[model samples]
Target chain A: MSDLSPVPASAVVRVDLPQQPYSIAIAAGLLDRLSVQFQDVGLTGKQVLLVSNPVVFKHYGDRAIAALEAANCKVTTAILPAGERYKTLRSVSKLYDVALKARLERSAVFLALGGGVIGDMTGFAAATWLRGVRVVQVPTSLLAMVDAAIGGKTGVNHPRGKNLIGAFHQPSAVAIDPDVLRTLPAREWRAGMAEVIKYGIIWDRELFERLEAAERLDRLRDVDADLLHHILTHSCRAKAEVVAKDEREGGLRAILNYGHTIGHAVESLTGYRSVNHGEAVAIGMVAAGRLAVKLELWNAEDCDRQTRSIEKAGLPTHIPLALDPDEILAALQADKKVKAGKVRFILPQHIGAVTIADSVPRDRLREVILGAMGNG
Target chain B: MSDLSPVPASAVVRVDLPQQPYSIAIAAGLLDRLSVQFQDVGLTGKQVLLVSNPVVFKHYGDRAIAALEAANCKVTTAILPAGERYKTLRSVSKLYDVALKARLERSAVFLALGGGVIGDMTGFAAATWLRGVRVVQVPTSLLAMVDAAIGGKTGVNHPRGKNLIGAFHQPSAVAIDPDVLRTLPAREWRAGMAEVIKYGIIWDRELFERLEAAERLDRLRDVDADLLHHILTHSCRAKAEVVAKDEREGGLRAILNYGHTIGHAVESLTGYRSVNHGEAVAIGMVAAGRLAVKLELWNAEDCDRQTRSIEKAGLPTHIPLALDPDEILAALQADKKVKAGKVRFILPQHIGAVTIADSVPRDRLREVILGAMGNG
Candidate 1:
């Protein structure tokens, strides 16, 4: 333990779920020290199944294996195809085949070493394989690092919906190496900034002000080191705190889905092609802000500030021009967020305060979406 | 709730899992009253996916649907192919498609209306669909009525193994109608007796003695009503108690895998053909008893009593002649119970008592297998 480099105290966020509490470690170059992080979290499994995508594996797969093997772990790699299209039960079934062939015992650990797609598939595979096995998330993408990986919401997308099949199987530990974000696509970086900006508007006003003061919020290279660290930690901390309060999205966790209701609908309506998760979330946040203002739930000035932050992050603040407004509304009904024929929306009352509104009028919602797309 | 006939208090076993406690209602004709049972169990979901096999669905599908519809549930049926071979992720994926098409919400209920295969697949589908939904197990076969349906151990089989892809998602309720056993194959009736006999040997000496006293145990018709009721309630009570104490099989739950260790190896070696689950368990119990006696943990007379009871039930008590003893030993290594390369065995200490043994001698196990096959 002494020979291994210690992770900074501030970099680790502990998610205190009642049944299965775990820590999320965020640091640069933490991927190379994956074994130490596993050990720190008390995961002593000798058999490790490292699940990743080809693109991420090409860059950090060898280092991840070397670190695991340093602790005498027997590592098996399953490199899935890179993209949301391949995230299905067929892919998870392939992991099950690999896991079964490798004779992975219940004590075996699953290490997810990629972005949200790989992390979700691997985690779902781990969740259902032998009922469940321990998983350690090594999220390389900013979106996964700050949000997806910390929440323990793992699943694959269905043809009709995204993340329609899943489980709330928490990982034993999460090791986030911000350094790997350097290789992420530029579009994804801006997409991830959308979530960072979301944390500011939903839970942390100080974090919002910090991002508002930044000169550039679009690219990883453009951001200063201090704010980057703050963005990662603060977002993760906010997610962790909410998840701890409501691990299954029963109550408090719904607030975390502030933009996801419409965001998911936009992603679905576009077939998840043009608008990625973060970009859709950005557009949804804009729509939600306008709806709040229109309904007198929040001030127009606050709504404008929210839109300006999304613009600064280079995220879309309007529905895609090609999609029909009615189709988006229909897609919203099919979303996982809907309950008993009512569309539940998370509308903000202030910069850092939001409330769940199940009775949001349909006409008002349609008008806000149309206005965002310049059709109102 | 008032108009429906009350379930006999003696027939219902409440599985008091800390987070998700539920009830198991075992009655003679409960299949026709499934809705009443669901309402009693607090499952008020309006959308239901009724999963069954061709055989069970042919017998009672309409009745089950009519019962749910009586309670205003919009039930959609998915009739999967019958048998263990079809218990794969592909089968589950089909259910996912049906669920998506039905637009089943998180508040939806998945009612499994067949044997272990249907129950397992439906429960697993419910466990993973939309992260999870409520599931009601209406197990038809005797094997399912007493064992599979009551426990929340839901899963599908991988090509290489049984129940490799699964989860521990407890059903909202388990409704076991003993009358469904009337259409069950005679072989299946005897197979379920094996589990009933198991409950006797492991937890209830009285139940074991009652089975020993039965004039005929090969078919459900020959078994007297009082003893049959005792078998259903007692077995479920034992299972529910064990699962409540150890929900995830941490310690106490492993006891439920008593004959399953060797039983699974035998089933896997033969490709789950010729010898069904209960028959294999019967043979495994004989091996475990002899091994316990050889190790001075149990008496020869008690071992003989167990073998005689298995014979009465018309179940195999010896390893098949075609399977190599060496291959059986190898298969045990791949069993889910293996940890740190050691195969864990649940051996009987006495009637109504058992203990887990991890350090059983390999040579002794081989000799027991050889002796059971008349090769010693």
Candidate 2:
């Protein structure tokens, strides 16, 4: 790991969509300076609805409220239940009630102040409330700050599949306070590292080397603050660049889903209980790496390096033994990316390179699942 | 009215949104030629989920199916209950189930084949199903052909208000077969004229003069096919031009809500049973006309002419006596346009001009409502 240094005052990454352009502010203590950050982005003296889960609100709600109030903004709060299970249209309906009760106008902003679940639900609510409104994402978890918070993909889950219902609603701004990560659960912290490793494999070779060099990544305290800041900045820049090229996921953005196709199947088959998103992605990446090598899309050496990087981040690189391979295959067929019953895989070509493969044979997919489970 | 002339082979009005631009195809017997239309829009040989209401499906489902199958497209169907009351998130959830059961892919097309309710729900389903898919709107009712199906505004109603939940998803193509209007109910036909009158008062003076020249607009037979075609073309063109200028309702598009502010209130206060959308819009237009005259925004003569034009369409020009004025005021406050509890209204400046008014005194709003009810 690199030597310790002060985290920069703040870094700005812009999401340059022609219709709704916004910036993300990454800093160490942004929550305390949120009023100025919002003001800098032209959000001031407005009615702001701050949405958070009970767990997140208990930790950071007061600071959020005080900051907005300090900027002469009228603040209203809606505390939702915590959990991925609570990310639903029903939960979003509750937010509408809050906005309506508060008489939030079109100009009012919705601030999501939690992890990915809260960010997704709040963003969907903001998108549908009065057709659309401004949303400012205050992502507290590493997964959200690095992935969910950077993109405009906002939605709730259906019993049939994850994010089966949502809108591509860009936020007015994204505020990431790395200090909030101190309270994130250990499992979630490790889970987020999987995505960071994903960016390294698919877009940034240097980031991949950095992960390889780090001695410890299992916990927040294991890594120095400067290293953490670099990870966040590099990962966000990779995402921002990809999103800028394809705001609606027409083409290039699909690479960001290198492991998500299989990862989603694993998550669904486990009922989203056995493995969290980051953990599932970690496992999916290992399978995808093997698939790439077998298909000759990438050499075996690069694939092995990819697997080692995932391991270095304290994430699992194998499928759970309890989940059936057949069920995973069925879930894959039902995935959103399956066009005409054919699954599309985002396979890596080498470090910092990937390609979308729409013609993966079903037998290969089945074999990979079973192989990853150690039953091949 | 002008002499009866053959309805042009087809009238195509393009909604020129830079991100997702599409065309509205207005033609006679277009349902039989659905295959060709879908191909013209680059949506051929795809898996299609056709959504319609039981009432509408009973009328045109077989023909629509035959046409798509002729194009070599695989088709599935889901029929929903017909009515504004059924336009809810629960109804949309039913669509998600249908899409999942059919294993509809991201590249699949969701075709909405009914009036406003069916189109809104289906478009929303397409928007959220797998984050988004291609949606081709087949509008059956006159209200849909001219207004609801043209703009990308797709949503369902909330218990609190109408269209309180939705996304702005532009259709890949809007196929309007005017022949289907032959089976439309008399009330719905009359209801559609209210929106036609709205376009006249807001943007097109020639349309206003044409409506005044027509002897009657009570039913499909009352107006010749030529005049009806002209009405659809002009109204749709007006909408397309306005939407092209402002796709997101930022500023120029608010003028499109000329009579909708008070119209929504009347619909909500009446529980959406006593009056349909177009009828409420008719009454709201009369009230807006009166308010415009009283505010000296337009002369009383012009306002009277506007009322006469609405009356010529065989629609009501006054709020129902049973609906209380105070409740109307309360509903107005709850309208999506209400910013900080102040109601913003689109008031007519002249026959072909309007301006958004955000500072109307409360007493004047009340007086206009009472005066339009014949109780001033």
Q: Model 1, range A226-270, lDDT digits (tens) per residue?
A: 778889889999899989999988888998888888899988887
lDDT per residue (tens digit) for residues B1-376 in model 2: 2354444456899999887788998888999999998899878898999999998999999999999999989999999999999999999999899988988888899999999999999998888887789899999998998899987899999887999888888999999888899999999998999999999999999998988899887878988777887899999999999999999898999998888888999899889898899998998888998898889899999888888877777888888888788998888988888777799999999898999998899999999988877421
**Clashing pairs in model 2?**
none
Cα lDDT for residue B85, model 1?
Answer: 84
In order of appearance, the predictions have TM-scores of 0.96, 0.97
User: Once model 2 is optimally superposed onto the true structure by TM-score, how far is the C-alpha of residue B73 displaced, in angstroms?
Assistant: 1.5
Classify candidate 2 by CAPRI docking class: medium
DockQ category of candidate 1: high
lDDT of 1 by residue, B213-305 (tens): 999898888886677788888888989999999999999899888788889988888888788999989988999999999999999999899
Best by TM-score: 2
